[model samples]
Target: MVSRILNATVIGIISGIVLGAVLKVIEEQTTKKVYTLLLNIDFIPILNSIQFGEMGEFLFHLLFSIILSFIYMSWTEKSSPNSALAYFVKASIVTFPTILLYFPLSFLALKEVPAINDIQSIMFWTFGHFMYVIALSVLVYLQQKKPRS
Candidate 1:
């Protein structure tokens, strides 16, 4: 159980970092602000009281990713996914709803972020999440493939 938690945590950190960096680069190059959207915490009440800057906001995002990884790994343990493709599909199924979060997050954010209805930003956000799931799937697949010592 401790090993599983550690593995999930590592997967979460890596996947979260990949998603954050990808969106950040996209926002920097295209000015879509999807990265800003990813890091927004203004809707969370008390957490919105102060600015956490990029790194802090990123840590907040990592928290969610880690929690999500825990849940996903737990589910995978039950489901016993046998292939990389199966892991990818399960990860996608688990995270599909997050793509829609762009709408609510944009609406609720007090800080500057992409508009709720911005089509381009929505596309970028969806793409970033797809990448995130891919990262999670690949990492989880690799971890599961390892022989237990």
Candidate 2:
């Protein structure tokens, strides 16, 4: 049990780092910004505003990945190799709570810290969450396909 938890944590952190790097690259290329959720509030500024040096970025990714991993595992407790579609189902299930919780929280946070005083900014941020959901789905699918030894 301890080993499983430890493995899950390590995997989560590593996955988070990878996902964060990819997200960072996407943000840089598209000039999009990312925020961190704080106290059920999105407190961080646009990704571009942050110094987000290499170390800071890595830590951000690592922490998020760890959290995501645990969420994934918990949501898919009964999933197994025999259930090929289980990953997609679990991914969809996971997305619901995130969208419900993060959307309003993010909207309020952004409203409080108005990066751009326009409707487009709100739309873009909301769209970004959709993209994140897709990414999470892909990540969960990939992880499920990994061979266990």
Candidate 3:
């Protein structure tokens, strides 16, 4: 159990960093604010009032990634999909709901996040999440691989 949790944490951190960096770069290049959106907590009531800098907000996002890793690990442990496509599909299934978070996050955020109905931002968010799904799938696949002599 301890090992499983540790593995999950490591995988989560790696994948989370990848996703965050990708979104950050995209936002920087295009000035779309997807990265800011990714770390937004303005809907969380009291927590929203405090100013969490980029690193702090990123750590907060990583916390969620770790939780998601734990959940994904447990789920994969049950069925253990064998193929790349299966892994991709399974990860997509798990990650699909999170892609919808853009709407609510935009709607409730007090900060300068993208508008709720902004199609370009929505597409960017979706693309980022899909990249996240790919990272999750690939990492999970690699983790499950057995070493041989």
Candidate 4:
């Protein structure tokens, strides 16, 4: 059990790093800035303007990705190896709330309206988060398909 959890955590961290990279790529490719989630880090006293106001954001995204991935991966292990379509449906339903989670966190941190500032911004958030979930599903599915060591 401990080993499984450790493996899941490592995979979850990988997923989080991948998610962060994907978002960064999207930000670079798009004209609009879509990763303003870090702007709300003022809520954390110790992280105030961490690493000259950059590392905090990266840490936040990475940490959140790890957390979400850990939960999903652990849960996936318990579930039967269902069809790909069913897995996707389950993932989408589960990960569709990236915005919902972000909004409140940002609001509490910034004391102002957060998330969905515009359609473009919201789309970016959705795209990044859903993509993360899809990636998790793919990894888990691949693992399930592999022969046990």
Candidate 5:
């Protein structure tokens, strides 16, 4: 049990790092082009700000990923037929309320001061959350699928 938990934690951290890197690359490339196209603007300043201050984001996601992995493992342990698909469905259900709640709260708490009016920004932010959930779910599925030795 201890070993399984430890393995799950390690897998979660690795999954988090991979997901974060992929997101960062996608954001850099896509945001750069999108911003440039929309406003004839460069994303250097935004990227610089993030570079200086992204540790909290990374830690938060890492911890959340670890928790999600544990939850999925627990669910799988219940062992119904089609457990993998059930886990995926359960994950999606769990993610829905988070998606619904976080975006408005994030906008209100963080972006309200600037009064962000860009629909694209809103969409991108929500899309990031969706991708995070998907990544975590995939990690959980992969961990659950590993053969016991």
Candidate 6:
């Protein structure tokens, strides 16, 4: 049990950092407006502010990633399934609730981003979330597959 928690925490921190970099690069390379609005819930003023700015957004995701990993790992104790498809299923469990929470929470933390915005923006944002799931699920699956030390 302790092993699982420890492994999960490690994986979560790694996942957070990797996903943060990926998301940042994607946002930078492609349309900044989409991922910026989707991933960041910082109020417009803070987001635009000279201090903390983008770092604030990255840190928020990293912190949540660790917290979410603890929650998700706790649920994966019994009869471990270890397939790619299974990973997707587990990740979906994490992803859906995250999106649901994000929509409402965005308003509280930042301005309410219109969910009914452009189709491309929504699509890319959703893809970014899936990318997050992919990173998490892969990390979890890798840890699970390793021989218990």
Residue 88's C-alpha lDDT in candidate 6? 64
Each candidate's TM vs. the true structure?
0.96, 0.53, 0.94, 0.76, 0.60, 0.73
Residue 143 Cα positional deviation in candidate 2, in Å, after optimal superposition: 7.3
- Off-target runs (Cα >4 Å) in candidate 5 are 30-52, 79-84, 108-118
Could you give candidate 4's per-residue lDDT for residues 34-129 as a string of tens digits?
A: 455523566778766555455656667667666776677666777875787766766676677775665555556553333445567567767777
Candidate 5 residue lDDT tens string, 1-149: 99779866886677557556655664576662221121111133463355323565467667866876676566656753255556667766655664464334434442222124555555554565566566656666776677877
What does the lDDT come to for candidate 2?
Answer: 0.53
Q: Predict model 6's lDDT versus the native.
A: 0.66
Kindly report which residue pairs in candidate 5 clash with one another. Answer: none
Model 3 whole-model lDDT (C-alpha atoms): 0.87
What do the candidate models score in CA lDDT, each in turn?
A: 0.91, 0.53, 0.87, 0.64, 0.55, 0.66
Worst 10 residues of 1 by lDDT: 42-51
Q: Please say which candidate is ahead in TM-score: 3 or 4.
A: 3
- Quick one: best lDDT, which candidate? 1
TM-score ranking from best candidate downward: 1, 3, 4, 6, 5, 2
Off by more than 4 A, model 2:
35-61, 75-81, 99-102, 108-149
Candidate 6 RMSD to the correct structure? 3.8
List the pairs of residues colliding in candidate 3.
none
Better of 4 and 6 by TM-score: 4
Instruction: For candidate 3, write residues 1-149 as lDDT tens digits.
Output: 89789989998898789889888988999899889999998789788888888999999999999998888878887998878888888888888888888888898887898899989889988888888899998988888875634
Best by TM-score: 1
Candidates ranked by lDDT: 1, 3, 6, 4, 5, 2
- After best superposition, candidate 6 residue 147: deviation in angstroms? 1.0
Per-residue lDDT of model 1, residues 1-149, tens digit only: 88888988999999999999999999999999999999988789788898789899999899899998888888888898989999999999888888988999999888789888889998999999999999999998888888878
- Roughly what TM-score does model 6 have, to 2 decimal places? 0.73
Worst 10 residues of 6 by lDDT: 105-114
